[model samples]
Target chain A: MPSAEEAADAVDVTALLERGRTLATPVLKKAVDRLAPPMNTVAAYHFGWIDAAGNPADGDGGKAVRPALAVLSAQAAGAAPEVGVPGAVAVELVHNFSLLHDDLMDGDEQRRHRDTVWKVHGPAQAILVGDALFALGNEVLLEIASVDAGRATRRLTTATRALIDGQAQDISYEHRERVSVEECLEMEGNKTGALLACASSIGAVLGGADDVTADALEKYGYHLGLAFQAVDDLLGIWGDPESTGKQTWSDLRQRKKSLPVVAALAAGGPASERLGELLAADAKNNDFDNFSEAEFAARAALIEEAGGRQWTADEARRQHKIALEALDTVQMPATVRAQFAALADFVVVRKR
Target chain B: MPSAEEAADAVDVTALLERGRTLATPVLKKAVDRLAPPMNTVAAYHFGWIDAAGNPADGDGGKAVRPALAVLSAQAAGAAPEVGVPGAVAVELVHNFSLLHDDLMDGDEQRRHRDTVWKVHGPAQAILVGDALFALGNEVLLEIASVDAGRATRRLTTATRALIDGQAQDISYEHRERVSVEECLEMEGNKTGALLACASSIGAVLGGADDVTADALEKYGYHLGLAFQAVDDLLGIWGDPESTGKQTWSDLRQRKKSLPVVAALAAGGPASERLGELLAADAKNNDFDNFSEAEFAARAALIEEAGGRQWTADEARRQHKIALEALDTVQMPATVRAQFAALADFVVVRKR
Candidate 1:
């Protein structure tokens, strides 16, 4: 039997893949220009362009993961595949918009193998960039509204609000300590799951799915998002950068209040005390000064010793099972369900 | 004889005069849970609550101008008086959103007789607040969408994009040496006019007007925005702080590419050359020894002699006439139109 990871990869089936890029770049292009210059050089670095200093890099960046999820969803929901492209582009743009702001909010120095937008263009420019991307996303939605002109209204607005709600909690959680498992899940639910779910549910809406089907897709994506985040958190602490694009043990060193760390902190004992001390020390040093390799190692030990990592992993598995159940109940073709199911497994279990 | 300025002030009967405070505060509070206490403090400071340091100010600070216009337009459109309160609150929040980011971009130190949000809360937290405000604006729009659903979808999405278009041009012009008068107006239309237009037009939409009526309200507010900005630009250069709450001629000193200055430069000659020198000198001054105070005074004299002020004043009047015509076409109540007309006059003539 094929492994679950391989099954998820089947979601991107060579057979089911649409024939073209097939999305309107012109309508989206004006929104992009209205938001940023074609020649800001730095701002154009994403969506395929030269870098900030006006030099060419390898190529376009970021996986367009959210947008793809959106497009795939529309297709899976049985919409004319081409029709959902605008919404796909829209959801993707919204995702990038969040990334732009989140980087600045987190003071993250790097993204996509280069300096983050704020670091390259200044924070003001970064903020404007995020605003532009957001506006473009809304613009794309309006274009889709023109296409449907009827039901498009409610669906697009709901998705946009869900987008904002997700981000609000993500930023809010940065300085928070003692985040409960449920709270972390809620934060992720809004910050990541909500958008992912919107991507699929909106696709279903575009595809003309009934409310029940749309709701099922939304749940599937929600669970998928939780699993995706859990896997990402795991990578943050333990994965290798050649694959993940980050140095190992970053989450630990940064004292990120991820689900795993939250679990460790909530456990409260020798392991918990040690983890708390490590967090306090990191806070004092800003995870920079006096944070030696030994300290990092010690912190990781405390977290694992407290069973934080295992708890988060188990949580991810539980959510994954729920996602499977949601997909199973969707009344979709078995082939399609298997593809998404496999994809869900891939997202949650990826080593990177 | 009633001067146009006098008539305009009289015409702009403030909307939400009764329900203004009630609508604004509660709406903002509901959108967000103050997850970060320090951020709450930062947002409070932006709202003109406590001084930047967390000490309470005497009382309310902002004039609620934008929200008032929104309410008035709703009423003028023959909607119930209480009907458009949420839209008013939303527009005001968006206005503040831009203000928060603008101060950070400009690196200004003060607002509303106290330190700016970034200065008090630092750049990171201020960024978060601005993002939150922008997000909340969308949420309010989503709330609007729930009622009309279709119109809300098209209107808010379009409005959001228009605002960003305005902002994009505003930022881009900062780097250009010589922007034309037409370009200046286009920029003003987007950066400043669009949101003001949206505020009024949204009210009309909420009031259940047909598209034609809503379109007219938008145009009215658009022209009004031009008039409003012209007056604001004048104050930036010449108004006393006792009135305008900002330094006199700071716009000139900073070489701000406002309509008056752009018009003066486009006219060219010895005056333009001298003004150019002042601008160039200011930029090159990494050290402040580039020019003596007398030299700066001489350039100022050149600009004054070139009639930049008179030219701007004339243009402001021209725009005001267009605004009045648009208002006449809007099919609003005669009394309401008269009130808005008064505000239009005040926009062109207001000292502060």
Candidate 2:
């Protein structure tokens, strides 16, 4: 009976995501169109909606997961999904803004199986268009006539500041030789958790949900966000190339201090010592491309042997359980609660 | 008698700018402090308050012209200058945000006699700190408890979008060979005019001014912004390097499609033809460093012979007149009105 219920929940989650994409795309289009040309063209390409030449393309824009969370959270707070469309659009825009800038800053060449905005259009355009999208996010929130627009704007801006702060710390961490687990979690919470928390609670605020309900939703989103990052960090090293749209051991190749890598280094064993030696050698060369396939595989083996993989998996589950517990603190409709639970399960369990 | 009054107005304008800097510096400092380190450090260095080593530096941060305009505009709307401090800080932040990003985009190494943020730090850090400042601007405005906070946020966001659009156009213009004077003006209006207009009018909105007063102030700002650009364009070509902080014919050396150059190309005379040939030759080599001093002098001569220089001067005066006229449409207090008129006079006639 439990297995049967889980299967139904999976199907429902898929349908909910589809509904979110349908409701959010048109409004997102309108917001992107508000930007002038070149910026508009650059943004369209980044969004996977249009080619560099301004011709439309059939492209996938992620799973619309954040937007779906917003709509579902709003529904859980007693408003229709349509009522959360503005919040969904705002979060989606902010998310893309981060992606555009991050791609440029990281010098990443590809995203969603295509050349990134900076790679195709140049960094200057990427920076400006990212800024435009951010402004548009703010504009979209204010355009909503709800009495909560001011609060929503303030909330979104606060989350955005946290996001920027997180990005700053992430960049700084890369330069440092050592980063503590506590610092990593704090950075993840700011970088990933803040926006997700905002996405989860903004809809409730817009829906005029009571303070208790909104606070509960926020906690749920925060824990879920941390869980999502842990899962993403795991996938970064271990997920299939086809599933993750990245090379195998991509993070390891780049010497990224992801959760598992950091954890393994901190564990201090033979495997940890070997991993540290290998990473230090790579750092000295300052070239990841010099690393051979065997070296990549060996590094992964060391991480796993150091118990990094098990620890990260366990941490993800722990956070996921806490997220669920937070959701239980709220008394939403049973159906809405189930959707939230399903989404949480999807976040932690997905291969990608 | 008129000359005596003009001299008095100049002194008063200087005093007003000093007062604006004094009031806005602490607020700006507080906002910058909100950002975490590395970003906070980069911003502090950019603002001329500190050096790259985190030591204090006695450096000037431009003229604080935008903040002064905000404070004066608030006074014109019957509010105290302190009432407009948030607006002043916000506009100043937005202005610095543009400056930081522009320096990175243009590969400019120097600003106000110091290394640019990107030059001192890196482009990625510059980009992130600029984003942080922009977000801080929005956050500061929303922190105001007055009813106008929402309206102010909306107005500032609108202007920021326009400013970005202008920047996009400006970058696009550099890649194009034949930009008309009309297009250049439009670009300047967006890049330079929009923020100036926002700086000029936001205080009025925050002061709870009537619509008529706000509209007049906006128009005043728009024209003043155009006039400011025109003067800047002139200074770009012919001003003393020591005063302008740039080499003579700096705009031409970079082949920037500034207003005067665009106007000269559109003139279509013998001088225009010669200027076009010279520019085409320069564009082919893509090397400004190879040009001789005689060639630079010749290019400047042709621009003047084509009426570009004279036309720009006349246009500056014309716009200045229009800006002052727009201010006349409002019936603010006599003292505030005199300051506005004085500032207008100072804008067009300043040597640097």
Candidate 3:
């Protein structure tokens, strides 16, 4: 395997993501266009292909990380990048499906600095459009009419179930006063890890790679997902508002039981005790309306003082190292391995 | 083909439906059981397997008509009934997924003499559970790991898209002041017909039936779905409330654009004109809250007087006949054909 410095120098992360998006977008658009009227419009808008009024607009359509993983995984399995387009499209669709529903459930108004589908079209359209995209994802795979497609679909659906299970857990945890770090990790694994794992390996599965190689790639993606989510949780509290497109102490404002909060609570220091009391006070009141900016800043400070921030940063590095190690178990071209490593590095350190 | 009299005499519709439920219930339960905690609880409750608090209870989980079609289609394809269990479970899951989402979209509080998933649990859980079920449906098919399973999953996803399209049309139609009879039929054909078509042919596809026979079976089920929906629309307006487990003039109460209402509006007579004026009044007011039972009864009388009742009844019969004729195009055992014919007849004549 290439050393970390070599891997970073060998690949341009921005160009790789752009290439993956370029390869997958046409197929994704074609699949989505099959949807009937209002749903088609809603989906197009959510994908940032158009504005709310149905006019053409260039908007942010995520970072295309999942699609890049899919295309790279296929290449690692010794196939042309084109062989992974269906997997890339399917993964992107499923990821957006979760986003549409999660936005509604979380009651988030804006995503990527635009109104969410539920905010613009109401909840019904959001649910229906999300459902259509999921069905479209499965259809794209099965239309390949190969047994590999069937196996890939099984993998996709299994990951989808895990993703849903994670969402369910996330919601339930919001209502509870106590959540262990272990429980939080499990939830993140299901919610984030499973789908990323599928995205990473599904292309290889579709490329008819043996189970061992596909599994190794899946492990790589799964650990990468945990690392990515850890970075996300950290940013949710400490990110610059301009870069994250959210308010300061965003996770605290939402009373989200994110990794940093759970980790601090588990640390059992004086700062952790005070953090727990403050959060419990917020929970008891059942609203954050009266919370001052200083109050949120204080909570963030307490979490960091309790060593939550350092632990999480360490955890991210640990998971990233493990993810790269997984890739070493499978034989692939050095360039492909370097690309995967570069992507993992990008995920662990992304600002958004 | 046997005469209608002979077909009806040969098979007991109640026994057939019961047998289908018996065959499919275990696999369906197993699939639902795979869902994580609260979703599993919510799905169990939605399926009438348990009460609100999660204790075991025998509630009404639909009539199992789709499952019966699936199993019978497999039998007609010259396979043992057991071969169709996966298709039956998958179709049933998709059916209930739509129901859970539709009840939320339509603002329905009760179904099958009980509170809906959204009503008891909440809209978010309803959406999540419904999505979980949809994923489970695809998983059931693809886990079979054969090309035929892949084909069946493709057919299932396609039908699901059509069903969603129909729902989009249905929701859109509710807001408009005018809807033509042709448009209404097309909507119902998509909303109801497509899923039934998949249910009928998916088993045959799984059983490796030739496309011709599978297509014939699909045609039969599509017509049967229309016939079934016509009968439902009729019962929604005119059947005894006790028999239907609903209030009088249920469709009128919800302002649903059912077949009868659309047909009545298209009759172009004085009674049709009166019906239009009355409905337009309700639409203009944007609330049925002030409308009395007597007013709803009068609208029902106007619809019947406008020849809507006769046209709908005749349409159901015509569709039923076409369904029977489609069966004639396929070469199957006499008993299998008879069972299909019997099921169609029962659908047209059912009270609920």
Candidate 4:
């Protein structure tokens, strides 16, 4: 639990994110609009700015966390948030691009309380639109005209490649019965940590921060990303469907080899053995269709008994602390440091 | 139809292309090897450098025409072909990326007489590998360490966006009944012309040629691309399967909106009306599986009678002439000019 001061800081960070979204969204919308039609329409719908019929509609998009980190990092580097808008846009575009492709690859039908892009527009269009957005992100980064634009482009592309590598590994892991905790951590680092690290460092690079400062921020972002994923893995098992906007026990239902499951399997306890047996039986008999609520409840109990839930929760807190320590290496305004710390706390502690 | 002098020029040009393939393939292989497996494996297979079992196998790839153009353009601008190695690698990567995705999008099982990447690997792997190659292209460009590197990156990204736009339009056109000749030409320009134009101009830019010279080469490549497509369209309907490596009348079988088919439909002759009726009936009844050989021959004959075949052939020659004219605008060495002109002729007059 956060202290009173930290709670107030979280509220302040939330407002900062809200402002970041309001300011960055128009820039993002304009960038996406530059895509040729049908693509533009598809992108707009994916961003929740419009409906499938191309009419304006109110839809829930996430808290724009990555973009907020970009802006805050820029501010920490002694530049205004506006100076980081392009970085924000680029990161947001890439984030969406990954989401679009991952949904298709995972056969996910819904996202953010709405149908996925592949579900709504078909897989081919979704794939193409994702490609377009990836290109657009690079395009936007190059258009920044800063001395660091090339550097940023290279950084973003490298991170993107890492992200793809992670996704590919994730897909391959699904077919395997057991994945080590170390391998799971590395995958999460690549899958989720890479982009967040990019987001955290890109603004400082763009703001002309020195290499040391940039490196510190990158370290901060890297740990933050790990913590973020650890928390996300926890939520996948225990999160409220109303809050997560996903089906209950979504990760387990899909047999995802996420952090918690991998950790439990690596634990080698009786609960781990029993959970593995259940999964094997489920796979052999193709029995998920007849799986009962009681069975899901039992699985959850087994995971907790194996210390999967506590392991991930503790890991999240540990990583969060490391993230803050990394941030301490960078010299920034006190207010900016406070906000960054608050954001880190909010990331781990948020229910959704 | 070429004179004796021109025939000699064609042989020299063919040697140049062969030399380019030898030089560029190693560089391309190195770049692709940088991709993590199975992406690396998939890309290597797509390049015909290996087989599905990851063993060396002899597989026929095309003539490496685009990379040849890049090197030759650099030479035309008074730079050694080595100066344009990065350009060659970038263009070839982008070209292969498009081919991988296009094969999947078109449901093409074979390319260059072998199973396509998507057919051999799955669609998911194909899409990801295509994406990795696209990013790799940009990454390779940025590694050039010259002022031109940023400009080259921008040019490549712009052309890639246009290429995607063209593909989206092509997919949509497949569902349409009638499309105008002008629209078809515009689509072709975006689809085929854009990347070829980039390939032609990028080397000159990298070689530090003036903008005027670069623009002329760009025009040269644009026309050459159009002529190449015209020839390809003709071959799709009439070429022998032994040479084309595709089933005879394959485009007609797939109901592709090739240049000749669009022209034949737009001629508004009796043959055009009958051809349209046949297509409409085929689409409405979904009776392509039962389409007879005689009906296929009749469709080809009707397209010829409607002057579609002649019109496209004439257009190919016209574009070839224009391509040569554009080459004439550049004050290249006589030998380089001869080679460029020979390449243009080779594009239009090749039977397969």
TM-scores (chain A) of the candidates: 0.86, 0.95, 0.98, 0.96
Residue-level lDDT tens digits of model 2 in A94-188:
88888988888888888878899998998999899999999999999886645577777788898899899999998998888878878888899
How many backbone clashes can be found in candidate 1?
16
Q: Is the docking of candidate 2 incorrect, acceptable, medium or high quality?
A: medium
**Best-matching candidate per DockQ:** 3
The candidate scoring highest on TM-score is 3
lDDT of 1 by residue, A1-352 (tens): 6555555665653323332132534434445655546323445665545666677665445444455455566667766656566766677667777777778877788775677888877777787777777666666666555434234434544554555555556656666655676777777776778777776666666777777887888888888888888877877877787777776687776567788888888887899888887686566675365567777777777888898888889888988888888877777655566666756766676766
- Candidate 2 clashing pairs? none
Residue-wise C-alpha lDDT for candidate 2, range B1-352, written one tens digit per residue: 3442464375578888888899999999999998999888899999999987889997887867788888888888889888778998998888888889888988888888788999889999989999999999999998774557777778788888988999899998888888999999999999888888888878888998876887798888888889999999999999888998887788988788998898888999899999998888788785668888788889998999999999999999888888888987897876777777777777888888
The DockQ score of candidate 3 comes to 0.87
* Candidate 4 clashing pairs, residues 3+ apart or interchain: none
Q: List, residue by residue over B96-139, the lDDT tens digit for candidate 3.
A: 99999999999988898889999999998999999999999998
Looking only at chain A, give the TM-score of model 3 against the true structure.
Answer: 0.98
DockQ of 4: 0.58
Worst 10 residues of 4 chain A by lDDT: A2-11
- lDDT per residue as tens, model 1, B1-352: 5654565455424443434555556666555443244556667778876675578776455655566677677787798645666677667767777888778877888776677888877776676677667656655655554444346446655766666666667777877777888988988887778887877777767778778887888888888888888877777776787776665565765667887788777777888777776676666667544555565456556666667777888888988899888887777666677767766765676777
- Docking tier of model 4: it is medium
Q: Give the per-residue lDDT digits (tens) of candidate 4, residues B95-150.
A: 88888878887889999888888788888888888888988998888876566777
DockQ (CA atoms), all models: 0.37, 0.65, 0.87, 0.58
lDDT of each: 0.68, 0.86, 0.91, 0.85
Point out the worst 10-residue segment of candidate 3 chain B by lDDT.
B1-10
Name the regions of candidate 4 deviating beyond 4 angstroms. A1-11, B1-11
TM-score for predicted model 3 compared with the true structure = 0.98
Each candidate: RMSD = 3.8, 2.3, 1.3, 2.7
